[model samples]
Target: MKKRIYKDIKIRKLFKRYEIRRRLLLGLINDLSIPLEKRMEFVSQLNRLPRNASKVRTLNRCVLTGRSKSVYRFCKVSRLALRDLGSQGLIPGLSKKSW
Candidate 1:
């Protein structure tokens, strides 16, 4: 639990640090106006970035329970946690469903 959260934090930090560089490199690489040689340099720079820094490697984790699955993007909590909070009337506009 804590281990997953810690690792998530570390990855998030790395992503934040390298995100701009990655975007810039990708933009340059995709620009047709740029010479192929220059674009190849950008591609190489993109490949040199840390694996965890890539957006695809980032985990969508529940902010409260640290669960990595079934997390609500807007709420940032797992479905289980969301149910619990909603039942307790903690989440605005959320209520128990009825037949």
Candidate 2:
């Protein structure tokens, strides 16, 4: 799990470095005005980037427990951790609602 987080962070850093280029290539690849051969070249260049650098490759982990599943992106935490913190009143503006 730790290794996964480390790898995710590393890939994220690499992605940041190539982000602008990736977006530009992606845009060019989709542009109809670009020649088919040039578009193919852009596609190949995009594919040459490390697979891990793609945003889809990164797994979201809980900020408190480092759990990789059931993460709430808005809160940046796992449901379990969020529930625990809310119950404890440690998470501001969050609480356990009772019927």
Candidate 3:
């Protein structure tokens, strides 16, 4: 789990470093007014970027337990963690569901 989190952190950093440049290249590549040669150049530039720099490489992980599945993006934790926190009243505005 720690390994997964560390890998995610590295991917996030790489994505941050290349996000703007990648988006620009992609946008340029897709523009119909751009010359074919220029678009190919943009494609080459996009391919030259590190694979991990792509946003798709980033995975949602639980901040407290490092679980990867069922993570709540807004809370940055997994489902179980969210439940535990809500039940303990640690999360403001979140309450445990009771019958």
Q: What lDDT would each prediction earn against the true structure?
A: 0.91, 0.86, 0.91
TM-score for each candidate, following the candidate numbering: 0.91, 0.87, 0.91
Q: How many residue pairs collide in each prediction?
A: 0, 0, 0
Off by over 4 Å in 3: none
Which regions in candidate 2 have their CA more than 4 angstroms from the true location?
Answer: none
Query: Candidate 1 overall Cα lDDT vs. reference?
Result: 0.91
Compose the digit string of candidate 2's lDDT tens values, residues 1-99: 777778778888887888888899899999999899999999999999877777787788887788989999998999999988888899888867871
lDDT for position 71 in model 1 = 95
Residue 12's C-alpha lDDT in candidate 1?
89
- 5-42 per-residue lDDT for model 1 (tens digits): 99989998999999999998888898999999989988
